[model samples]
Target: MASQVPPQIFSRRRRIAGLRRARVRQAKRDAARYILDDMVEDVLDRLEFIRMSPTRVLVIGDWTGTLALSLRGGGSDVTEHDVATLDEEHPVESESYDLIVSLCSLDRVNDLPGALLHLRNALAEGGMMIASFLGAGSLVNLRRAMLAAEPDRPAARMHPLVDNQAASALMQRALFKRQVVDSRTLTASFGSLDRLVSDLRDQGLGSALANPPPALDKAAKARAGAAFLDTASDQGRVLEIFEILTLTGWKN
Candidate 1:
């Protein structure tokens, strides 16, 4: 007979699945507002080193396929791969792309390093990659609130967010040359706590926690609302942090 896994492990997996489903649902609902346009400008701003015109490009996790469309607008042949379901170990192809851009989507991937390697392989020797992803500094206030609400919980109520240092390390280890990494924190304010939560739902953020706290029951929801309201500023705005890191490297 196979050994039974601990209940906690099973619970954690279930929570992760629930979070993924919630994110997919949100993606379906808010695809237009949350996709390409939101991150493409930032990606382009950081891709200053790349020549304006490239022959072929590949985009991993083409959420809303905005990047692909943008590259096409710039007159490059573009191909897209949605890595969420495909075998991450084998992305698309090797040495085929002049540029590969990943935007705000790699944090949810299970094998981040492997994905990076696959991306590198997909690039020609001189090809460049410009990637932006959410960093660990994101959701500090929310994380603190959750921790305070459940001080004894072993795991975080949100997914494991990465920091700049960790992201840099991942990039450096990916065997790329001319590596440059930078991070920035964006603060978006909400008129009310409920709107903040709803915005997160709309953006498909924070939907991959291990053993996430159960959905807010009536009393729990009341408490959470009170807590966020207490933290509101005099201007009646509550802030949420989005820590984004941009990494650039070239295949040697």
Candidate 2:
């Protein structure tokens, strides 16, 4: 059989643009940005709790530079590698770093298993790697709204996310020596659908699909808005949940 090529699920150009967009919006964070705040804070707390003090550290997808700065402040030499690439000559050099923390990037990768493998390859023996990203059970309201927008046949508007169990399986498949996976749910209230979309865009949650659906027309947009409104609570606020899946493991 001929070798099989991995289908393109995300556009590299779009992914980079999303990250850059998030970086620019970092200064004007809002309640929606609590996703990143919760993740980064968890990474820091885990490092402290585990008492793993590595001299060399690598951070990926840190739009705000907070995590890397904290690591540096703690006396760990830090490298902020924001570029997304996985190859033999990867900038992440094999067995180079003592610890690697990836945030909000893996979910956008075309080959998540391959990405995790590359991350593992870049770690020194017994080194640790922790990654966090938006996972399944997130954006249920947005999805429902999009479906209601196109009542007939719905087009794929967002990427499929990995749940906690799937994340754990991926880490195991990545051949991590020892791994643990868990998820956290962060919720925010929005008064309108447009506000929710704006918040997602501002926090690096924009569409990076290889074949995104065409822009919604006026009628569809109105329907989607109405659908989102249907989910609002008695207090007239829509509660949206962001499931952040975290995986922590050791390099064999």
Candidate 3:
């Protein structure tokens, strides 16, 4: 049996729809390409030093299909699953895969521990699992803008992120061997507040909170825009920081 997803944390439908839309836009736009590309590249580059090349691979959250294609191109047999299709109890045979990779989706999972356990169960002995997602300290400027819009009483809008330490703990709890968690920050610049929000949407960074804050009314939206603009650099561009956490482990 799988653990129950906590309703207080995320909305599955919204998260799914956001990724689906992102998949579509990614074919035509470059705005959201770097993050996913960078993650896959990092994993592959590290695999070189480890002296391992997984032959049977499972890739989750290949919304733009880049990661899966990259693996297949490198001669690995690949199985792909969009993250939205995976539930807490999604079946995977024990010792089924030599490698598993998930990018940018685990953060939105309502039953993260359960998901990690399943991934571990699917890995063959000595097999590796590597996953990455948005982490704590991300989006400082955007968070500030939202709060400024409703200074008196801010609502729950952004999804909370798991920091590096917590991520390591989760891997240990899931019984993955050689657990490791680390983070890196990537900075994205935008010409305007609205453009920043649009880029987020394009990248499937929509709110996954189960009870999302009410839509910003015109007045509030205007205020947020004004506040966001005030923080622009001398070049008249706003920068948003994305802290990406990576978790890695091997099945014993």
Best by lDDT: 2
What does candidate 1 score on TM? Answer: 0.79
Model 2 residue runs over 4 Å out of place are: 27-32, 84-91
Q: Candidate 3: misplaced stretches above 4 Å?
A: 1-7, 88-94
Clashing pairs in 2: none
TM-score of 2: 0.93
TM-score of each: 0.79, 0.93, 0.92
Model 3 C-alpha lDDT per residue in residues 125-201, reported as the tens digit of each score: 88999998889988888888899889899997778889988899899999999989988889988887788777787
- Select the stronger candidate by lDDT from 1 and 3: 3
Clashes of each: 1, 0, 0
- The total of clashing pairs for model 1 equals 1
Q: lDDT tens string, model 1, 45-78?
A: 6554544566798776555666777778878898
| Segments in model 1 whose C-alpha atoms lie over 4 Å from true places | 1-38, 48-50, 84-89, 152-155, 210-213
* lDDT agreement with native, every candidate: 0.66, 0.85, 0.82
Q: Rank order by TM-score, top first? A: 2, 3, 1
Alpha carbon lDDT of residue 177, candidate 3? 92
User: Where's the lowest-lDDT run of ten residues in candidate 3?
Assistant: 86-95
What lDDT is obtained when candidate 2 is compared to the true structure? 0.85
